[model samples]
Target: MIKVIIIGSGNVAQHLIAAFQDSQNLGSEIELVQVFSRQTTNLSHLLDYDKITDDWNTLAEADLYIIAVSDDAIADVSSQLPFKNRLVVHTSGSVSLNALDDNNRKGVFYPLQTFSKNKAVDFKTIPICLESENATDFQLLDKVAKAISDKVSAINSEQRKALHVAAVFVNNFVNHLYEIGSEICQEHQVPFEILKPLIAETADKIMVLTPEEAQTGPAKRNDTATIEAHEAFLSNENYLTIYKTLTQSIQHNGKKL
Candidate 1:
């Protein structure tokens, strides 16, 4: 069996563990030998497992070491590992594969999704970005990735970096827009619940249509009167600025109804 050790107790680590457990392909071929964390209390959910550890020494026994810690601490944790030829990998999108200097055979297994401890992920649909130093390692990582996800892609470090930035725009910036809409509803004494359907529809449409094609609203339609009214209704300067900026972006991008 291929022994695997994961380092971290955060949402990513938890999600990864859950994914591994769900993968039938890896059930008999691979085993999760250890889960390392600084504070064991954070990993109470995994207490049933006999392989949980708060110390780095436990990592010595595993054949594959996965540093799922934060981007800043990947190198720190990797450098301390005792095994010289052990295959080491990290689950990060922004951090490059070369970040871990202890081993030259490092790779990245980035899951392109926002993970929260309370929220479960559908690994089957989520994209798994796999990369490694050479063809042999890349093939190994690809096999591991395909076992957990149907949408696995062999993306290099530079492409992975670009995708990470794109993810921030689509996920982070779009969520901020939802927040702004909620705040607007709250301030106007309107139920924020009313916007839920619209938000869901917006996301749903994108699954079947391009964001540019799904674009709607006064800006895309060039309804200046409605745009002016929306700007006038805004009580917060920041909110109005955001609205104006997005409107301009949509209009300048030549989005048509």
Candidate 2:
């Protein structure tokens, strides 16, 4: 059995806990030995209270220690681990693998998916980006990743960093645009649900088609009148700047298509 301990109690950690629990049904030998949280109460709802602890010294011996803490806290948390020369990995996309303490074998087990505390995600669909300092450690992470997710890939640190940047643009920035659209709908007393089908269609289109091929908009078509109208309609200076910049990018990039 692959004994595992998860450190931290955030969205990724909670989701991982649930994923590992479900993995047992799939014939996985992974075991959830313990979970570390600064306040055990935070994770008591998701994990057995007995399996959760606040004291780092109380961490059980395990084959793998997965640190799912924030980017800034990963180094501090890994450095404080009592044991050394054990396989330890962090669940971060942007943070480098070297951030972990050298005393332990370091790896990155980044799940390329957005996590929400309330929302339930299917781990099978999420891509697990695995990286390790050595081939042996990579094999272990690959086994554990495949046990939970059908999509697993070995990505180097530089490639992972590039993927993280692209993810921020596609996921985080696009979500912010959705928020802006919602605000616009509220201002006009229009139901945002009206845009649901359009949103769904836009997302679905990219599944088979390249993003460039799927692109369609006033900017892409070089409809300066429509673009200008949109820029004029925005009251916020920040939104106007963003609108113009994106429009310019679309036009410039669309020329190649």
Candidate 2 is scored at a TM of 0.96
Estimated TM-score for each candidate: 0.93, 0.96
Query: What are the lDDT figures for the candidates, one per model?
Result: 0.82, 0.92
Model 1 TM-score is: 0.93
After superposing candidate 1, which stretches have Cα over 4 Å from the reference? 24-28, 47-49, 255-257
The best candidate by TM-score is: 2
Q: Which digits, one per residue and each the tens of the lDDT, describe model 1 over residues 139-188?
A: 77777777778999989999999999999998999899889889888878
